[model samples]
Target: MLLEDMLNHQTKIPTEWHTSIRKVGQKFDSAAEVRLALQYYSIAKRFEYDFYHNEQRHIRVYCRFKHTHGCPWMLFASPLRNLSIMSIKNFESTHTCGQHGENAGNLRASRKFIASQIQAVLKVRSDLRAVDIKNDMLSNFSIKINYSKAYESMVHATNTGSRVVIDADDRRFRRLFISYNAYIEGFIARCRPLLFLDGTFIKDRYRGILLSATGENPYQPPHRLIVISDADKGIRATIEEFFPDAFHSRCVLHLVENFKKNMKDFGHKTNVATTLDELLQSAAYKFTISE
Candidate 1:
């Protein structure tokens, strides 16, 4: 009755699909091709390279492809192979230090460490809302880092401070920064986001632009995305103006807590909070407008 059931009925592989898979195998690295072949009996829809292990490996993955049959079949296909002709070796060796040239390996490791440190700090700061990373935190990390240099590097990378002027008018540097910023913005845009707009009073009694976007999860604090703001408006209005197509939801928990504190009668407040909680918790509330 199920698609898998139907697929299981045929023990032999379809000639067309087998031919297609063989063609797909040629596009990947030999290592990945081997993994693909290993999943011959088990249908593969996708694959990923595993790098954290001592030896580089390619993981054969599966996915459910739904169709009009009212049943889903595991598609043993590779989008990476069809769309891009990246050698399986490239995928497997990208994470290894020695696979690239010796100089490249050193640079790669340094850059990787710097990037990892920045991400770690960002994550911690986001969680605490303000992280005062002192000697204790530094010691715990087990790395001999000059915090000042590390901070400076991060600030430069984040574009919050002056960039190292290798060449002031270099088109290549401009292009690289532009591309990097675009990539970071794209990453943030795809995730659950929170946009906040405010003004920070500066010298000479003038206020500066203070627009920031962040990705928030109830399970964790959010990554900050700072951008210059142009106006004073309600958070909702600013969010709507900037990202009209984006999804937004008010913090109902905060709202309920505020309501409880304002109301004098505990019993009545509790009832109201319970009702509000039920209404918001319902799956229907998100898709429908509250009357």
Candidate 2:
């Protein structure tokens, strides 16, 4: 049987459970504790919160059958003594109706929960497809979600809450630029004044180039400068126009690949190409003209 099955059993509430009015005197440090208490009630009674309000000084939560109107299950909490510490003031754990259907459905499908599930998968494989996400959710949680829901969940999961600036021609995507917040920009200003510019072709249906600008920090990983169009001339002109003071350089691996392609196009023999490739690599590694 599924975990949901075990949780949905309508067993009698344990006498030692914390839902009794006696526990009302207990103090909760945060809203999470209040929610956990409600969740414990949910597990014991096989019902879930249909609505919840988290305010500055109090929290109100209501529980009912999934997709149904009010069914008399509710919980309310308020800050005790301290504004940050919440305590459950009132709760009605018993449901008027029997377990409505076996599946949790919308009860377990909060936006935050959906976003968390999407983010967990993306942390391991960023390239996972929408259909794959739908299938994964169904197989793992027994929840079937549509493509739009899955896509929206991914967007919500990845959004950094920063204003993203995109430049396009007649709404046809031309360039996408992202600016760091003021704090991050200030940190980047103190880093080494070097910019690494690189471009790779996007392998999507409407293929285009992805141009990236990155800068190195003193004791941390490189910081992204911007994302722009892949047109080489446009990229150079933009860089020169906006960031003229920074020294720019191409990625060595990309440059070597271009060199190898040119050599192969010239019909150079395998031994000649190998020798030239080795020499080019050595020259690239040299730090100064004398070396």
Top candidate when judged by TM-score against the true structure? 2
Candidate 2 stretches greater than 4 Å from native: 1-29, 65-67, 97-101, 105-250, 289-291
Model 1 residue 269 CA deviation in Å:
5.2
Q: List where candidate 1 sits over 4 angstroms from the true fold.
A: 1-150, 154-213, 216-249, 262-272, 280-286, 289-291
Error of 1 at 212 (Å): 8.3
Clashing pairs in model 1? 29-88, 44-76
Q: Residues 1-291, candidate 1, lDDT per residue (tens digit)? A: 243344334333333322333333345444545443433322211112222232333333222112222222222323354453323222211121112111211211222244434556665564322123323223433223333434444554454323332222433322112223543554455643444333445456443343334433332226443322333347558667876665545444444455555453555666776675566556334665654
Clashes of each: 2, 0
lDDT score, candidate 1, position 197: 32
Least accurate 10 contiguous residues by lDDT in model 2? 13-22
lDDT of 2: 0.60
lDDT of 1 at 175: 15
In order, the Cα lDDT scores of the candidates are 0.37, 0.60
